[model samples]
Target: MPLPDLLVSAIALVRDRRVLMVTARGRDVHYMPGGKIDPGETAAQAAAREAFEEIALDLDPDDLVELFEVVTQAHGEPDGRLVRMRVFRAETDASPSASAEVGALHWVTTADLDRCPPAGAEVLRRLAASGTID
Candidate 1:
């Protein structure tokens, strides 16, 4: 069965090459600071909301970078479902700190991308190729 819901995520790039990432308090992997879009919210709205929740950064709805949607091949689901991710880019007022759902925070550059989660690696690739990300 396919996953019922899609994930909408946003990448807030800073200093050209570094982007914001969050690690949930108990989680081991670093991921972009966005999350699931609630039933009534648009993908862009959800991206901004999640960014604020996870990183304590205030993202104006207008500031996010509009990138292509990503249809990620099934990787983690035992049921073999693809993940539809809507990724965006934007510059932030400042680097966000871990808060609420987040337990750790880091600013990652292309050089350090290999250490990030697979999804993040994909994002970096798209960013570098399209010039929307650093």
Candidate 2:
């Protein structure tokens, strides 16, 4: 396997609750809101930009909350042929605004997340255990 570049992903939370879960058009898995960090862009900047482009929600780099970082593959990402994503976590009062590239946006509770996507569920559990969120 070519293997994907190392990536960092973030889970968006609001009022100590996770707010967004992203699913591509054909994907059954619901991942967090995040994307690749451009060579010149800082991880924080990339997080905000990706949120806007992927969901039409404008976010400030400062709004990015430091969630645990993880590495994942981009072989079948909805966008580019390949990429390395650096993810972050933040809270937003705004609802998810979809862009052309995105298929659906769902607001989920920490409890609900577990049933929707196993991978996301596991991450949330870890983050919760780490005191990142309640």
Clashes of each: 1, 7
Worst 10 residues of 1 by lDDT: 73-82
Q: Write the per-residue lDDT of candidate 1 for residues 100-128, one digit (tens) a residue.
A: 77888877766667666566767777777
lDDT (Cα, 0-100) at 22 in candidate 2:
74
lDDT of 1 at 110: 63
- The numbered model that scores best in TM-score is 1
What is the alpha-carbon lDDT of model 2 when measured against the actual structure? 0.62
lDDT of 2 by residue, 1-134 (tens): 55455454454654444457777777766776666576887788877878888887787888776655543335445433344444466666776766777777866556666544334665666666766555
Tell me the deviation in Å of residue 38 in model 1: 0.7
Off by over 4 Å in 1: 131-134
Off by over 4 Å in 2: 1-4, 72-87, 109-122, 130-134
Candidate 2 — number of clashing residue pairs? 7
